[model samples]
Target: MSDSVFVGIDVSSQTLEVASSSELKTWQVANDAAGLDALVSRLLELGPALTVLEATGGYEFEAACALQAAGLAVAVVNPRTARDFARAMGALAKTDALDAKMLAAFARVLHQHPERERFVKPLADAELQRLQALVLRRRQLVQMITSERQRMRISHVAARPSIERVIEFLKTELGDSEADVAAHVQRHHAELAAALASVPGIGAASVAVLLAELPELGRLDRRRVAALVGVAPLNRDSGQMRGQRSIWGGRADVRRTLYMATLTAVRHNPILKTHYERLLAAGKRKKVALVACMRKLLTMLNAIAKNGSKWDPSLHNA
Candidate 1:
């Protein structure tokens, strides 16, 4: 395997570049079926051990999928990590070609394997993705509507009728999207969805987000699920300074929805409520108490998903 060359591909909307241990190849091609075929062919000629690409929105996903289908080992890494590696290598100046070379070099030096995180794919649920996106847009529109309403109270509303119509249309579209998700969930992940909704605060929206983005929750251990959602805190300590652990860097949508749900859970779910009160009585700040509730909620969700059971309050009591 060591004798086999590793290939790094830097993919963009307008160009593609392939680099191996011994040589670099660049191709100017659109990101389409034709370009994808050409790149796969060239990669086949190299017979590289693995191919690496950075996650550029959804720009590289289709191409990566094509390569994977062709029986090539492909990994798409977070672009931030790749860029940081580039800076650490002292290649500050940026160009697509250089980034491609740097990606290959970074892979060789770090031995970073293709992202082990697997998203359930072909996603078979483009409608779920669309529905999730609609929910996000609805949230944004609600914010806009709120802002506009406040503005109307104080001054003249700007294009109020137009904005109102847009909001109404979005709401209607979101309703259809919701129906699509419900239909899909019923057909496939019905049990998981039912188990998730059995929790006190997990609602249709929360369940939808989980199904669309973090469908792997059913397979992950408790702490791992929390960490992936960015609700798990990390130790903040150093040689001379120490700070409290804080949660950071994961899907903001999941984290935010879970935060609100956890708050409601801590208030209404007896098991979580007692736990929340205990933490608060121990002099923990409300924020810290809420985080603990969030962790507990995630643990319960994971347990339910793994065990295929409803939320058990008796077992969950702190």
Candidate 2:
């Protein structure tokens, strides 16, 4: 195989299917420590340019980390992206082996298009991963508590106690999760956390979401950061027919969290409030102006993150 060979790995809880784009060779190994070691050994021997794996709900975590630790360019992509690429290639058959091949092909595409490689940044370190789990579980508990509160209105007295008990447990767990998230941020990302918290609307909740989910926040440029959080508008146009350009397809959690923060900022943040009012005066709908404020607030946050500067009203646009 050539030195620039691309590899695709379809990871599962049980096995890892490794495919090589150079010769289309496929092999299987157990998805354990030894198997990952052997897989990394093989990749190091081949000196592949880039390795692609689909994120199979944390199943890909071990192998991707092992490969990345071995200094391989490992990209853990969304499974649906690989599947859609397979369909485009006229391969509708579903198999772990075929999925590996598809991922290998996609890896080759990414290898050629270096600019798009931002989607496949390296895996989070252990500390950040733990924080992410805590934040995500807290969000789940919040959802469950909302459901339980709704059910209390219609539930019988006997049923209400059981529901209330669960709600209490969930709230306790949520509090613990939030504490863990804050401790982690303070321990590892203290500077970033302080910078983000300097903004009026970004409290612990918003900072937790940004720190846990968007680790690449400070490293990317403003435009790239906006797009990463799914706030950058996308175009849909065809010959003399222009469709609305709207943001879509990125980190939903980050975007949703930022939307909440922006809602608060537009009301209280001096720079954001003025900018929001300008858009409103320019005949923008309330929701439209709000979204614009959200994007603006996001860019300002990105700038602060990028430069390690505290939030400053005079520097909002700069």
Candidate 3:
């Protein structure tokens, strides 16, 4: 048998189901510190060419980080991508063990994929991870506050006081989370934050989210960055049958933040505003024009981050 091996791990909150391509062997381990340590040790012996895991809402982070730290190449892929691969390969059944094996096969193919680097990059460092946690906390707090407000509207008069109290507490936590995000950015990412904030419509919250969720913002080219954020329009065509081009999957949180920022930019930021107005004048719908503006704003930010420069309207005007 070839010494080259590929491995896959299906991660869940409680256990990890692991499979290896060389022998088609499978194993189970608790998804905790000791289990991760043991798994790393075993992988070191096998010396797999690549290991793949699906992003199970952050459940796979610890295992992925552990493997990466142990000098193993790891790719954390989207679940949708994994499922598509499974269906294409005729793997209809679903179980932790089966998923792990399918992922092993996916890893074999992914090893030769051109864009594998997109999934195999280094995980965020401690400080940035902390910032991401703070940003996510703030998002949760905001959602709770919004829900409470909605309930308050249709809620009984007797329930109003309780809802209001919960909203107040959530708002307080949101403020604290915002403060933490700000302090962390100031301490670790002040320069990057400042550059992003120089754009007219990008505010502190957006800056934090971008830094936290879209770490590849400055590293990739404009198109790749736009695609990564799910703002890049995709084309569908079959033998001269052209389908409408539309944006598809990418980082939703980053896209949401970018959309909000673009809303403000189309009204205030001179370049984006002009571009938006031109698109509308040319017969584009408001939503379509706004999506274009979002792409433009993202690319502008990408360029700024890449060049380590601030937003200069003069240079961009042409």
Candidate 4:
């Protein structure tokens, strides 16, 4: 087998199905700390080029962190892109072992690609991980509060009181979650957070989401940053038939936060307000203008992060 052998592990709630490119071989192990250690040891023994896994929500986190801590090159790919690759290769049938094979092959191609290094983002730092957890908890609390509010409005007289209590409890939790996010950022990522927050129209919530979700914010080019956040316009040209360019997928959490911040920026921030007005006066729809502002805002933030520079409208506008 070549020294540059790619490996894949399809992680489920109970087991990890591992596959390797060296000899197209695979095996299964329990999805636990012991199994993860075993898997890492086995792959290291094989001298892998890299390991790949689809981001199965939180299932892949432990293994990824384990591999990363072990100094292995690991890539947690988007599930949608992995599935599309499987479809392209006529591997439509689904099974853990099969997924392991597909992922191994995907890893091989991904590593060989010119831009492979761009896909190899380091896992979040411990502080960022903690921030991510708090942010996600805040999201859950917000969702629960919303659900309870809806239920309270349409519930029986007795049920209304119970739903209201739940809503109140969730609201309290949400506030605390936000506070934890603030304290964590101040303790660990204060400078980065401050640089981003210095920009007009960006709030604590937006800064928290960016710090937690868009770790690539300052690490890439403006175009890559925008695309990563799902704000870039994608081409849709076929022969001579030009189709509308639209964004489809990226970090939806950061994108959603940016959307709201852009709403405010387009109205108040001098530079962004002018940019928004120009787009609108150019006959672009209000929604399209707003989305462009989102990209512009993100790109500016990316620059600010990269240069360790605080927000300056003059530089950004120019």
**TM-score of every model versus the real structure:** 0.85, 0.95, 0.95, 0.95
lDDT of 1 by residue, 1-318 (tens): 567777777888766776777675554556889988988887788777667788886788788888888888776777877898899989999887788888777656545434344211223245566655656665665566677566546754666676567667766765776676677677767888899999998888788777776766768877777877888889899998998889887667778888989978987888889889999899999999999899888888888888899988887763
lDDT of each: 0.75, 0.86, 0.90, 0.87
Which regions of candidate 1 are displaced past 4 Å?
1-4, 24-29, 47-49, 108-162
lDDT tens digits, residue span 84-200, model 3: 999999999999999999999999999988766555434787988899899999999888899999999999999999998998888888888899889999999999899999999
Cα lDDT tens digits for candidate 2, 198-247: 99889998998898888888788878888878888889999999999888
Clashing pairs in 4: none
The top-ranked prediction according to lDDT is 3
* Candidates sorted on lDDT, descending: 3, 4, 2, 1
lDDT for model 1, on a 0 to 1 scale?
Answer: 0.75
TM-score of 2: 0.95
Candidate 4, 224-265: lDDT as tens digits: 888777899999999999999998787788888999999998
Can you tell me which runs of candidate 2 are displaced by over 4 Å? Answer: 1-3
Q: List the residue pairs that clash in candidate 1.
A: none
lDDT of 3 at 261: 98
Candidate 3 global TM-score: 0.95
Model 3 clash pairs are none
